[model samples]
Target: MTETVKEYLRIDGTEDDKLLGFLIDSAKEYLTGAGVKGTDSKRYELAVIMLVTHWYENREAVGKVLGKVQLGLQSIILQLKAEGLKSE
Candidate 1:
């Protein structure tokens, strides 16, 4: 049976929260590189879901490293978004 999309996406207000966001952005890039469409790639989705669960379970250790990475990524994304808004 096919696994349904996981609900952990709703997690908020922790270091893992930002890491999850970064993982999602990375997963989209990965899927695109593999020629997979977001709507049709169950395989990509499942892979991301599993990786997220692994991170969540190990957050005590992973969170410190991920938090630093996520902060940098979040800053970049915010800058891009600001530029886009200014351009429009």
Candidate 2:
């Protein structure tokens, strides 16, 4: 997944790559910890929803970061799907 993410970021040439990496790391850490207790699921969901809403509403720096990350993720998924199909 990290390799896929890096590949995606490499295409963008955006300076926010480091910040995006940090956010992805933090989200993974939080999700791991949350999964241990079996609580915090709603909190995590709410946090994501709020963050997305804030990005859409602002349409500024944060929104740009979000857009790039989304595009990267989409590319990664598409690549993975293609690879899976090739294997089959």
Candidate 3:
């Protein structure tokens, strides 16, 4: 998952591996708390990767919002939640 996120972010170093891993876990927890247990593998993985990218790029507490990331994350979360409901 770290590798996937790193590739997605075009990161070429291992120094941030630990931070990336932590972000992945945090993303999973956030999804779970938002009712997106992510039964769909691709969606789940993508969500995690997307979140890690967002967090990695915006480590500072105060920063301008990146275009599409905020909207895309919300959209993916909604999709995951809807799928979870359907499966249930």
Candidate 4:
């Protein structure tokens, strides 16, 4: 798990084990509270880890990225609506 986050963040070495473990725990807690229903896929788990790590590394970028992600999700919703597909 730490390896995945390290790879995503392009980090190397053994100096950040504690910090990465803490962030991994934080990511898990955050995802649990954020209603991630399943803990099955590695991709999903890695995404949460990457997001938390990104926020930890760059506080300012989180807002911008979040805004862009929200807008992208909104666009997807609109497209689905246009196609008469229901989105929960």
Which candidate number maximizes lDDT?
Answer: 3
**TM-score, candidate number 4:** 0.59
The candidate 2 region of ten consecutive residues with least summed lDDT is: 31-40
- Candidate 2 residue pairs in backbone clash: none
TM-score, every prediction: 0.39, 0.31, 0.83, 0.59
Q: Which 10 residues in a row give candidate 4 its minimum summed lDDT?
A: 78-87
Estimate the lDDT of model 3.
0.78
lDDT of 1 by residue, 1-88 (tens): 1123235555534555555676566545644453444443344455446545555556665422255444544454455445446656
Question: For residue 39, what is the lDDT in candidate 2?
Answer: 27
Of candidates 4 and 1, the better by lDDT: 4
- Encode model 2's per-residue lDDT on 1-88: one tens digit a residue: 3334445435356565565555545544543443322123443333333333334345465534355555544454455445446656
What C-alpha lDDT does candidate 1 achieve relative to the native structure?
A: 0.48
lDDT for each residue of candidate 4 in 14-74, tens digit (9 for 90 to 100) = 7887778777776566555544533455545655665566666766664233654445434
lDDT at 4, model 2: 43
Model 4 C-alpha lDDT versus the unseen true structure: 0.59
C-alpha lDDT (0 to 100) for residue 84 of candidate 2: 48
Candidate 1: where is the Cα deviation over 4 Å? 1-13, 40-44, 51-88
